[model samples]
Target: MKNTSSDIEEYLVNVPEERKEAFKKLIETISENLPSGFEQGKSSGMIAWQVPLETYPDGYHCTPGSPLPFLNLASQKNFIALYHMGIYADPELLDWFVSEFPKHSSRKLDMGKSCIRFKKVDDIPYELIGELVQKVSPQQWISLYEKLYKK
Candidate 1:
């Protein structure tokens, strides 16, 4: 479900009790793996880690007043969602993830361009996810963003 909560804590509080621990674990993994200069906040009804607006005031394309989103974790109606911006920005990264995920995970990867859906907590490949999250630092992300879309 789309959360209207303004804070991460508040957002987590609204998650179903049975699913809260998994969500917390996801948050912990994200917190531990993210590179420097990413700030955690609420965006698009999900918990997001982004390049702070102070670092790049141009912010997101859709929401220029908001920070540029890097990763977003959301509890969707049917599954948990992890949006990794690195994969979206770099085609090689997405290809690698698709090729490598099945090698390491028993669960089928449910994904779009960048959104990975987890039907159960066990469906997550924590190590791979962490590695993917760590692939780009804030500065690198900004560079990639500008290179791809700064026209």
Candidate 2:
């Protein structure tokens, strides 16, 4: 189910009680370490950090006028999921994250093309996620996105 909150803070307030603290901490970690040029907003009901439309006038091709999405965090029914567009677009980054997962946590990585799922709130590797959040700048993400989009 999608988060229906129009505002980021409201979305936070609505997170299920069991996942509240970890979800908030993960959000805080991303906010603290996210590279410059990204703006925080709500996208498709999830909390998103994106390259602003003003910065990248083309916006998201999938949703005209929307910013170019970088990362999104959602509290799903069973897990907290972080969707990172860069990891989907960049193979090196995906490989790096896969290789690094074991060093950060013992729990097996639960992931999809772009979604990294943390089933146990306490199992989330906040430090590793913080580092992952820093690996891509808005400009870099835009360039990577364009290269893939143009293909």
For residues 1-151, what per-residue lDDT tens digits would candidate 1 score against the true structure? 8999989889999988767888898899989999989999888999999999899999988776889989999998888899998898899889889998987799888999889999887667888888888889999999999999776
What's the lDDT for all of these models? 0.89, 0.93
RMSD of each: 1.1, 0.9
lDDT: worst 10-residue window of model 2: 142-151
Per-residue lDDT for 1-151 in model 2, tens only?
5889989889988899999999999989999999989999988889999999899999999888889898999999889999999899999999999999999999999999999999999899999999999999988998888889944
Error of 1 at 24 (Å): 0.7
Best by TM-score: 2
Model 2: per-residue Cα lDDT at residue 133: 92
Error of 2 at 116 (Å): 0.1
Q: Candidate 1's error at 95, in angstroms? A: 1.4
Candidate 2: C-alpha lDDT: 0.93
